[model samples]
Target: MIVAGFACLGPLVILGEYSASMLTNQWPPTLPLAVLAVIQAALLTLLHRPLTAIMETRPAQAIVFFLGSRLMSVYLWHVPAIVLLTGVQLLWWPMPDPGTGAWWLSRPIFVVAVLLVVWAISTVTKRWESPQPILSPRWPSDAVTVIAVALFVFQSLAISSYGLDLPLAVLGLVCTAIAVVLTGGSSNVRAPDVPSSTAEAMPPSPR
Candidate 1:
């Protein structure tokens, strides 16, 4: 299945590029794009078992858990890290022209710099990502949870629509805080136990 997934990659890349070109030319090749997405998903389905097996190993489990713990921080801070790095670079030195050999060569260094910045940011912000102790015993009702989610989605859309200016940022923060508070508290429910096995230590798949 993994071999089949790899084999599909060549055709997938070709079709993807062709679809991209069509979109770039202001011609929406919807069918081709949809086919590409389906094929990509199928490839992932094919590769899933083998990838899961690989990730079940101890070393892989360790790496996965370490990153998984701070996954949200990594996602949220990476773009800001890139922007910060680019600004610092602009202050210190002129940027190489895009598509130049120098520009290509600098990509690895830039990526490493971004990762470092993200790591630093994650150290401070990871506490937020970690599961916090419930402050109240009252669990929120389903209706309240839905409303909190709706408010969060609305605020997120508002931020995206009106750019992340100071007011919107504050509004987003307020909305997110409210959502968290609304959803916060303890319940009698408990998570299911994993069976004792080498694979049990690994985090559950994101799928």
Candidate 2:
């Protein structure tokens, strides 16, 4: 959104001097905002850990609760909600171009309307997508989980910000290499007990 705002501002402010054609064009001051948003999201997610532990420390339950929250459910239903709300809005106050004029570009009313529509749709979808029961222990080992999560975050960000270009492909390969190394190292570390029938049989000879 910050990037989009910059794109719009460029056209108006500098007489459309900034490059807006290419996908890799400068997004002006969006990097700071993006970084801040990422940091805030990480902090907020971490903040939930203590609260979640206080409520229930079970890993499965915690994972379900985290993913099954209203925020996530709402995102799943946002598209359908947008369709419905657009239909209703068109019927009532028909907008030819929602983002045409100066005020229209950043209309809080329109934003609120879309949010309301999403919330309503989310409420309905949440009924169907209720949190599933905690079955088996689904979490991977810590190292594996961390690598998987990092890869996922990077891939998701790349996909959203830029297409699957050379840079993203390189990033994906690097992540894969790191993950493989970590996993290999973890697997090389053996447990203390070495299983053997001879050792088990001769264990109580002196005792």
CA lDDT, every model vs. true structure: 0.76, 0.61
In model 2, the runs with Cα more than 4 Å from the true position are: 1-69, 83-109, 127-136, 142-147, 163-207
Per-residue C-alpha lDDT of model 1 across residues 1-207, encoded as one tens digit per residue: 445556665686566555334323223434445555666787788889998999989999999999999899999989889889999999999999976999999999999999999999999998888887865346567776787899899887776555567888889889888888777642432334447884677889778
lDDT of 2 by residue, 1-207 (tens): 434544555444456333333333433324434444556676667678786666675776777675566677677667666677678777987565634784476467767878887766676667666657754323346667677668767775675566556788788778766665665445534333546975777657554
Provide TM-scores for the models.
0.62, 0.36
TM-score of 2: 0.36
Of candidate 2, the 10-residue stretch with the lowest lDDT total is 20-29
- Predicted structure 1, TM vs. truth: 0.62
The deviation in Å at residue 204 for candidate 2 is 25
Best by lDDT: 1
Error of 2 at 94 (Å): 8.0
What does the lDDT come to for candidate 2?
A: 0.61
